[model samples]
Target chain A: MKRKHKRLTFVGLALLLLATAAALTLSAFEESIVFFQSPTDIVTKSVSPNKRYRLGGLVEEGSVRKKDDAVVTFRITDMANTVNVSYRGILPDLFREGQGVVTEGFFVSDVFTADEVLAKHDENYMPPEVADALKKSGKWNEMSSKMKKQGHVLGGGSQ
Target chain B: MLHRFANPTRFLRIASIAQPWIAWATILLAGTGLYLGLFNSPADYQQGESVRIMYVHVPAAWMAMFCYTSMAIAAGIGLIWKHPLADIAAKATAPVGACFTFLALFTGSLWGKPMWGTWWVWDARLTSMLVLLFLYLGYIALINAFDDPARGTKSSSILVLVGLINVPIIKFSVDWWNTLHQPASVLRMDGPSIDESMLWPLLLMALAFKTYYIWVLLVRIRAEIISNKIRILRLRQVHG
Candidate 1:
């Protein structure tokens, strides 16, 4: 082979090896790499209560209940299953009913007792006027249903 | 055909002509993009004014990945074909890519504080992007570590090629894992979810960033060529 062809083979071989190594490493750490588990994932896996993990899903509409001293309780749902979460302290500015969220804690009895709660916003972005117009035209519900059909993974998840 | 522009004199001539046009394009695109982003575009229904940060943050993030990919490709060409200009091009791209990565992280943090309620997280998307920033920095540091410039170039080119793996990982992190960061809005199988008004500023800003990279790369490559000449002259004088 020419010197250039020889160098090409070497680089190509190196890249192939590196890719294989990365694939193996990422697969090995797949479980840990997932930042949060959806309510459905939790239900199907029946995860142990002894371990702490992040629970993520949409905050179910009309499920938020504020208690005294900055404690709030809500239900996180994947549209297929729901998990009750109780969080203390302040919620993020983006936290709201019908919005995506992730709470970090372990299950206390049946409820998820969260120490850290984060809002996970979706990719959709539209002006307030457009949103209002969509609502007025009754297209908002259609769009929302379309999103639901796509899956309630929030930011695309392993599920 | 690949080495048609391998001659430094010919390359310099072309770069000199293209540089001013790229510089002006950057200024014009950036000015219009800022205007549209800050004023013309309406506030997001949910994020409100904070959504404007996307114009800067998203473009910077795109440019960061773009630069790294381009750098890796140039480095690979330099390694396989022994192209001096390719090596210079890869070297010139490093600091610019690093700056874009830093801007993405900084703007992301600012945006995150109000939206996500945190400055940072260890989520897969965010973590992989952070790793990209480190890879750029590591490549820069490695290239400068050796006294012998040729050795530095060879080693750093290998490093750049190896680091190319992170680009794909970063892009798919949100999809492969549950991340706090949202998935792609623009470069998705489905068309961009963003409204047309919001998307215009984003595209303009991304174009502006691309032109800025080209303008800077040309200047850096010219400087590198001159410096190489100076080094050669000094070595010849001393040896003679």
Candidate 2:
């Protein structure tokens, strides 16, 4: 082979090797790399209470209760299962009923004691006027149904 | 065909002609995009006025990845074909890509504070983007570390090729793993989930960022070519 062709072959082989290595490494660390686990994972896997992990899912509608102190209680659900979460600190600004949430803490007994809470917003973007109009026309359900068909439930729905 | 413009004189001539037009387009597009994103566009129903940050943040993120991909391709051509212009192009692209990466991170932090309740997170998407910025910085540092400029270009080209792996990783990080960062909205398998009212400003800003990169790239390439000429002239004078 010519010098140019030889160098091309060397680089091509190098890239292929590197890609395979990356793929393997990512797959191996897959469990740890995930930012949070859904309530379904915790329920089905029956994770031990000795270790701490993040629990993420939609905050169940009408489940938020604030006590006299800073403590707040809510239920996180992926529609298949629900985990009770008790948080003593302030929640993120975007935190609301039916919004996506991730809480990091320990699960002991039957409740999750959360030390931190982060809100996760959906990808949908629209003007408030449009949202208001949809609600007025009672077409909000139709819009949410469309989102469901696309495998995304923005708010107040099962995934 | 690539070799036709490999000559510095030809490259310079073409770049000179194209530079002013690109600069004007950048200015026009950025002005309109800013006006639409900041003033004309509607505030998001959920995020309120803060969603306007997406106009700048998303475009910066896209340009960061786009510039790195272009640099890697140019570096590859330089290595295999020994094209001097290609090497120069790759060298010129590093700092611009680094700046865009920084802008993305900075604007993202600003947007994340109120929205996500934190300035930064160790999620797959955010961490991969941070790695990209480091790759750019590492390339810049590696290129300048050598005493001989030719060796510098050769070694840095290899580094650029290696770092190309990070681009795809960054793009798919949100999907492959659970992340605090949201999944792709504009460039997903399904059409964009964003409404037309918000999508237009985003596209316009993205175009503006592209034109700005081309405008800066033309200037840097011209400077590199002129510097190379001066160096050759100095070498001849010393020998004579």
Candidate 3:
């Protein structure tokens, strides 16, 4: 009985330590999360112009412009709203108009000035956030149908 | 019902019959999955060929989470019901879970540098996953830290039950915080958000991983039981 009591105490102490550590770590991160926002989210929410964030969507058709050197500018849209993004780095090889793009940068004077740009290169792939942005803005049926026509089958999972 | 299968003789008989079938299924499914992933699947529109990494990465991530979950559940049974088999099963699962977690992180990093422009980020999702790997290592270490095997098992099982708090956090990390990691389309609402062509390979790989876990787990448990038997026999001979 004495040995069993000691084991119980040890278990309790371990639980206490784990709970403390988890609580501290979780609270520490509560203030420092970078959210991936959609174009519609940018338009509706007042994001600080200087704070860095990730913005994802399909590049608007015919909106990509190659400027001097490697710098380029484009408009990304969730079909409900669009945001302008400018980047100076060499774009990922897959960056193209009418494709899913996720950019990490800051807003300067309402323009998303991206430092990095990532494209969904799969001929059939759509980034989930971009898809959600379109769906939440109620343009999914129209756009998703068009995407489906491109031979992109919706992935299998529980609805 | 639990006690009925607690006998090692019964477990060995059942596992012997189940082993070959599970092993072959793993080969068949994983082989098919590799072929389709490497050849049949279309190059991603954006990431192009690099997206094929998901055939391995996503499944590994799933197995890492799956193994930890089953271990925790087993550990809980050991704690509450004092089931020796439960603890032994949990012990056997640790290294396997750790390997899967490591694969997830390694493959994810390889996928990341080309896709995210960086091999790693201190983002919530990535950091939480790294923590999970550490937790697995810690569990394995703690289990062996003690001289007495029972003490080691008891303490580690307690640690495991406590470590389980991380699972939900890992699953929701992307959603709860802003992250470079893509949000889950495969396990989320309104069905899979990704295309079906990619989804099939991912699912098959997941099944293959699960089968691989069971095959290895049975072998590990059998070895553990046999080692224990040898230890007991040696002790009896010495005392007599």
lDDT of 2 by residue, A1-159 (tens): 398898898888999999999999998998888888888778888777888989888799999999999899999987778999999987888998877888999987899999999898878888999889889999987876565344343222123
Please compute DockQ, using alpha carbons, for every candidate against the native two-chain complex: 0.80, 0.54, 0.20
lDDT for model 1 comes to: 0.92
Model 1 ranges with Cα > 4 A deviation: A47-50
lDDT of 3 by residue, B1-240 (tens): 988788888988898899999999999999999988898887654566888899999999999999999999888777766777888899999999999999999999999888766788776778889989999999999998998988999889877888888888788776565456666768865467667777888889899999999999999988888888998999999998
Worst ten-residue run, lDDT, model 1 chain B? Answer: B1-10
Which 10 successive residues of model 3 chain B have the least lDDT summed? B174-183
Ranking by DockQ: 1, 2, 3
| DockQ category of candidate 3 | incorrect
TM-scores of all predicted structures = 0.97, 0.95, 0.77
Q: lDDT (CA) for every model shown?
A: 0.92, 0.89, 0.79
Alpha-carbon deviation at B169 in model 3, angstroms = 1.7
Cα miss at B174, model 2 (Å)? 0.9
Worst 10 residues of 2 chain B by lDDT: B174-183
Roughly what TM-score does model 1 have, to 2 decimal places? 0.97
Which parts of model 2 are misplaced by more than 4 Å? A136-139, A142-159
Best by lDDT: 1
Order of the predicted models by TM-score, top scorer first: 1, 2, 3
